[model samples]
Target: MTGRERHGTGARLRRMLAYAVLILFALVFLYPFVIQTATAFKTEPDAAAHPLSPIPDPVTTEAFAQVFGGTGFPLWVVNSLAVTLLITAGRVFLDSLAGYALARLPFRGRGAITAMVLAVMAVPGVVLLIPKFLVLNQLGLYDTYTALVLPLIVDAAGVFIMRQFFLSVPPSLEEAARMDGAGVFRTYWSVILPMARPALITLTILSFQSSWNEFPHTVVAVQDPALYTLPRGIANLVAGSLGAGTQYPLKLAAALLATIPVAIIFIVFQRYFVRGAAEGASKE
Candidate 1:
């Protein structure tokens, strides 16, 4: 064969190999979700019998009924929504404020504040579980919504993301606003913030997802069932009555329901998610 023909054949082979690898990985990652979704509609016995099946023999919504009616799932949903909304709002606002200040403002101890934030970001979350509980208990905020939402109001990662985004944006925008007699806060609120929609949306989605799926923190923060978030409530359900029978369908349904909001947000804001990922990679 000619050298050009040989090179073309090799390129085609490599493309085929790459596609095969990608398909394999896609199945590896997405198969579990498909199984979970399918099993959710199956009867308890059918789920056990056909663990790998993607089609249930007799599909039903009884599990969903039980989740919403019989259990405290509705209450858990309410609690999760309330807490997630509060935390998302708080984190978005406070983290952006802090991020902008750290990025643009000139003040004493700015470097020290930046260093401390970086250090705090490096600390493993699990390590704070016990200490957080202790502080909450000491401050008499234990088992309250305040306990759940307050500690997470300003995440270091969110602050870092906003700071980096602000840094990347041209300083001239803020300078123009300042020259037009805009105060610092006015410049941030009316000028810079309008331009920060992409980063802000990314942070909002991330904060919502993180707070919604928060389990370990909820476990450490509250003991009352009334205060339980969806993840914590579902965990308790699985550990307690739901475990007595092979109620894989019910458990899976609950999990699927809990995952829907985050999934919707992910799909809707997929572009922002991609941008955030690219920015993060560039930072690294």
Candidate 2:
């Protein structure tokens, strides 16, 4: 074969290899969900008999019915929604504001503040469990919605994400706003915020996912059934609520329900994720 023919053949082979690898990885990542889904639809007997199988022998909705009917699942859903919404909103707003200040606002101790935030991020969250609990106790907020929502209102990582994004943003835009007599908050609210769609989306997704799946913080913050979020509730279910029984179908159904919101969020914002990434690259 000529050199051009040889090059074309090699490129096609490489493309095929890459596609094969991606498909393999997709299966590996998706297999669990497939199994979970099939198991959720499975009879308790079928689920127990074929634990790893991704096909249900006898599809049933009993597990789902039980999740809503037998447990405090609906209450758990409400608690999760309330806590997740509060935390997500708080983090997005507080973190973005802090990031803008760090990036644009000139002030003494800014470097120290940035370092402290970075330090907070570096420290393991587990180490703060006791301190957080103690503080909650002192504030008389334990086992309350305040306890669940207050502590997570600010996140260091979200701040860092926003900071980096703000730094990448063209300062000329802010400068123009200033020249037009816009105050700091006004500039941020009108000009900067509109331009930060990608970073905001990233922060939103991260905050939602983290807060939705939040277990550790909730465990430390509250034990009241009325305040129990999905993760905490599910943990109890696995620990003993089934009375030494392993109900794989019920467990999978609950998990599947818990996972759906985040999945939908990702699907809806997927294009924005890509667009945001591309914009970030160009901005940087």
Candidate 3:
């Protein structure tokens, strides 16, 4: 072959090799999820015998039935939904407000407050568990839904995300609103928030996913069985709720069910996540 033709052929071979490597990695990462799903449909003996197999022999759904009927799975779902929704809404609204103030508003102690937020983000969440429990106890908020939902309503990471995003927004937009007789809240509500849809969507997805999968915080927040969220309840299920046998099918089924909502939300809003992140990274 001619030089250019030889180069093109070599490039095609390299491209094919790269694709092969990527496909291999994708399968490796997805293999566990495949096991989880297939095992959920398998009988206990079948699951234990062919744990790595993606196809269940003599497929069954007794596990799903048990998940719905035998345990507190339904109650866990209800509690998770309520708490996650409230936390997502609260984080979006409150975090954005704090971010906007840090980014745009010129108040005293602004720099100090911004530094404090960043510092809070650097602190490990587990380190604060004892203090969180103590505060909850002192406020008479322990073991209540209020205890579950209140502390998580605002988060340092969420505030940092919104602040960075708001900083990317042009100051001229807010100036124009002010010139048109809009007050601070009016400008934020009517002009700024509409333009912030991409960032808001990103924040909403993160907040929902974080709250839904939360386990450590729930340990301190509530003790009532009725107050348990999916993560906490699933942990209990695995610890001893099934009585004696391994019950792999039932466990996997419950865990699989818990993942559905987050997966759906990510699939739906994935396009906006990249856009918002890119916009936030750029400065005017």
The most accurate candidate by TM-score is 1
Note the clash tally of each candidate: 0, 0, 0
Ordered by lDDT, highest first, the candidates read 3, 2, 1
TM-score of each: 0.96, 0.94, 0.95
Question: Cα lDDT for residue 99, model 1?
Answer: 90
Which residue runs does candidate 2 get wrong by more than 4 Å? 277-284
Score each candidate by Cα lDDT.
0.90, 0.91, 0.93
Model 2 C-alpha lDDT per residue in residues 134-179, reported as the tens digit of each score: 9999999999999999999999988887887888878899899999
Off by more than 4 A, model 3: 1-3
lDDT of 1 by residue, 172-236 (tens): 99889999999999999999888778789889999999999999999889999899999999898
Error (Å) of candidate 2 at residue 6 is 2.2
On residues 161-212, what C-alpha lDDT tens digit does candidate 3 reach at each position? 8888888779999999999999999988898888889989989999999999
Give the distance in Å from residue 162's predicted Cα in candidate 2 to where it truly belongs: 1.3
TM-score-wise, the better of 1 and 2 is 1
Off by over 4 Å in 1: none
Give the TM-score ranking, best first.
1, 3, 2
> How far off is residue 229 in model 2, in Å?
0.3
